[model samples]
Target: MDQETAMRLLLKGATAFFLDVPSGMEFGIDMMSWATGDKFKGIKMIPQGIHFIYYSATDKYGNTAPRCGFFHNFKKSECLVRKWDPDKEELLNVPREEIAQYKTNILNLDQFLAPYPFEEQTKWNGLSSLLTENVITTLCPETTIIRSAMELFPASKTENVKRRRKWGPIRTDDDVGYDHLPNLVPKAESQFRFTEPPECHYPPGSSLSQITKHSLDSSYILEKMAEKHHNVIDLLAELQFCYICFLVGLNYESFERWKKLFQLYCMGKDAVAQNQGLYVKFLLAVRQQLDTVPEDFLVDIVENNNVIYNGLKELFRTLESGDFVLGDDLKDVTVQLRRFLQQKFGWEFNGLDEDDDDEAPVIINFDEN
Candidate 1:
């Protein structure tokens, strides 16, 4: 649903959950961050308690507004998902407390449901749970876990049959029922785990070498021009090198491995420190998604560099996506690169060809207080 509709339909007193976090393990509902708004602090989306999602924005008083949330942290297996109430549209902090229990036969099924959201919800019952629950009625603390294994096939694994994660309380066999009445949760081909792609070698392309030299030369000029300022050209130059290093690190583990040794992650490694940390997390998440990706989506890069890719796209798609650019200073570089690509039959002849223009400046606002 559109963010607007989602806000309208989602219930108030709601919570969210993330199955993975603390960078790579399940996080609490209270720790999730709302996806909307200007608050720079971020949060993970909680995987459970999402039944409260509304299709349109509704204020605490039930008025309509934009929606968002912010998750600060997760602790003790409980989700502390922070949220943004659209009515006020401010970031909120919520903490989930973990409760421990033992396995037992139960009389009231709601006891099993009690550990879940106490309010109304959409139960996306995966086939593994659905099939298992029928044979066994008592759900101890252990049963609630959503196994990643069941997600591979659609409700039915048949061809032309679409797959889904969850269904509402009601189900029409027709919803996932395919021809021939095959089991809705059809068994799968032999499934196997995957290791990350082997790192590829990236020899410095001639085009990349030239651009690198040009960047350093440009930095020198900018340095001379801004002699009165803090003179951050060296810092920019280092960052530029780090960007290449990131691509190098991504393409080859050896390069990154070598980097980690001399790279004392204490104070001087520059942003590479954060990049290295995020890179590991990115790889892990990519591995998780690939576990069940539809065979149809094979070509999409699972290791989504969306933050870098979209940040660049934002400046190109619209002037309003961000206010990161400085006029004239970086504008000339954009014009030059477009002309070069047209003149030379240039392409990403090699990895890290230095194709992107650093037009959108990262504005680091110094705190005045």
Candidate 2:
């Protein structure tokens, strides 16, 4: 490291003191992780910004627990302290007094802490730049914990009893069926509070023609979803939030939500021209997001009819058409994104064949009035 860089880190970098964590457990900040050793306390020289801290406990037999993590925005030269609860196999907050004491004795404790891997910072920023403090606070569970495997609770007694009565008594292996299994649901407080997509794609009391248009385009649904946010940018922030949760926190549910949001953005042609600034930002966000996705995942996407390719094809077609007079900024970002996809994934936007059945427009015949 350069002397100036080291000095800057010493003055501004934050520290995380993880106390009494067992050896052989997996611990990480951002995109990197390690199987911790006996001397490992936590990470130091952490850049002051939003980051994810994750860990998993491992048993003596080498079986690792499900991953758990939280997002925290570190302040300049801050000291954060957490203690491991061996019995619970979870990280818990230390008392204010203990945290203060830890900060006071940080110099003596520094030797046990590892420096943050600065090399990964740029990659992390690419994935997380759009995420704001508000986004994390809004979307994360009330407990501020994200678990790879969701914690579930047994269904309510009334509902379970109703199902049991319908299924009747079972005697043997053959009798065991889906209805006989207990209904499990995620705990309310522990579930991510993602903004729910509009239940109905079209507006209430819309004409059949209007309904068909809305169904095909989803611009109305996108507009309704934006109404829930303070502004369009917050919607984009939620998009970023969902991606990070899926990518870094290893949450599959968040991945599903990300797909929903991505689809909404892609299908909203009218909304793009209406919210030009948002689409420009949206394209940039998409570009950054694709960089973080693994090549294997892209292969799976390509095999599954390639929703991303189809979506972008429609979007680029709309921009090229003479219907909308798009701003130069939007046009520039769109060009950059097209070039990026071409270089990164061999995805060509120009001269694309319109062979997809999904692209066919819906036609509704209204009764003559």
lDDT of 2 by residue, 1-369 (tens): 997876578557998999999999999999899989999989989998999999999998999999999999999999999999999888999899998897787768777998898899998887788787888898899999999999988889766666456666533445656556768867889999887767777889999999877877867877887788777788888888899888888898888788778877887879887888988888988898898887898789888867678778877877777377989999999989999998998988765434555456432211111
Give candidate 1 regions above 4 Å deviation: 1-64, 79-347, 350-369
Tell me the alpha-carbon RMSD of every candidate. 24.2, 5.2
The number of the candidate with the highest lDDT is: 2
True-structure RMSD for candidate 1: 24.2
Best by TM-score: 2
lDDT of 1 at 186: 25
**Global local distance difference test of model 2:** 0.83
The per-residue C-alpha lDDT of model 1 at residue 193 equals 17
Of candidate 1, the 10-residue stretch with the lowest lDDT total is 98-107
Task: For candidate 2, list the clashing residue pairs, or say none.
Answer: none
lDDT of model 1, residue 133 = 22
